[model samples]
Target: MRTVDKTYVIKGKPETQWLLVDATDQNLGRLATKIAAYLLGKHKPTYTPGVPMGDYVVVINASRVRVHESRPETKIYYRHSMYPGGLKAISLRDMLQKHPDRVIRQAVWGMLPKNKLGRRLIKRLKIYAGQEHPHQAQNPQPVA
Candidate 1:
């Protein structure tokens, strides 16, 4: 009887990549989806469902991200407290001003998996309010 090997081989080194995305005048939902894909390694051929093989994403000018139609007023972000009558809601306009980065981050976060690996992938995302960021040392490639 001859023994055969059936183990799968995993090749290639996982290098840390830095990517920059300009959010100026970009649609919120569309941009978030792209960012989430990059953070989850969905754009790579070697992507594994449960592995953290994503890249670092730096989003600039998050304050300029836009939403279509009356979403600014109609869209409501909800939050609740453990106590009764503690439900809270805020409009998209308010959210953009108060926590601009959070708006985009939350959008992208929702598109990712609801697991430990997803949490780790989120750590690679960086959102900035202005055009300038502190990741210049990483030489992030500009996504055009």
Candidate 2:
């Protein structure tokens, strides 16, 4: 009897592609989760653990991302400046109005691995408050 090995291995560098996501009328959590997956290469068959095999993600209309109807006023995001009495809290409504990009960025950031790899993956995410983005040259494919 002869034993044969048939496992396939991915070599060379990973080909990074640009992905576009529209946040219009989409649930905040769901959209972020999908974006996070793409950032971590979880959607690819060649996924490798501890490897940043993901692609770039461009999010447009981030200001339109949907949250619970009543969450805007009740939901609070907190931040600390590492100093006494430095804790600050902002409501979802305010956050959306002031920095819509941060809303999605923070959401996706939470879903990625808490390590250097995660940091690198996050840098690929580009967000826009409207439907205009500068990555048109990359011809990013629209994603749900």
Candidate 3:
């Protein structure tokens, strides 16, 4: 008979890997979904939702991310300043032109758990508008 260690448990301090993803020409929703999964360690066999088990994700060419809509301008991102009549809305086109990185960041953020832990997990994501990034020291592998 084989004996197994029932009390054995893995810690949240899993070995983190660096993943490089090119956002160029990729659909916004699809790319965000994949990145969110990676951030939450969903791809790992030892994934525990309560534990912060994930890797660093570096995204490049975020400015070139595409949308499925024929007119992406119809998409709206809303925000509130928590003041009287502080509601504001920004179109996708404007967001892409003004701050492209925010587009991907917001998308991934929404997919993550809405809690303090989620906020901490999101910090692992690094987004760049262009192809250049300073995380080359990590030698991140291309995420296909």
> For candidate 1, lDDT tens digit of each residue in 4-119?
97543346766668999999999999999999999988787777667777899999999999898789999899999968999999999999999899999899989998889888
How does residue 124 of candidate 1 score in lDDT? 96
Per-model lDDT: 0.90, 0.94, 0.92
What is the C-alpha lDDT profile of model 3 across 38-139, one tens digit per residue?
A: 999989988776677889999999999998776566789999999999999999999999999999999999999999879998999999999999999999
Which scores better on TM-score, 1 or 2? 2
Q: How accurate is candidate 3 locally (lDDT)?
A: 0.92
Candidate 2 global Cα RMSD: 2.7
Q: Order the numbered candidates by lDDT, best leading.
A: 2, 3, 1
Task: Indicate the TM-score of model 1.
Answer: 0.88
Candidate 2 error regions (>4 Å): 1-9
Best by lDDT: 2
Assess candidate 2 and give its lDDT.
0.94
Model 1 ranges with Cα > 4 A deviation: 1-13
Clash count, candidate 1: 0
lDDT-better candidate, 2 vs 3: 2
Instruction: Give per-residue CA lDDT, model 2, range 1-144, as digits (tens).
Output: 999975544688898999999999999999999999999998999988788889999999999999998999998999999999999999999999999999999999999999999999999999999989999999999886
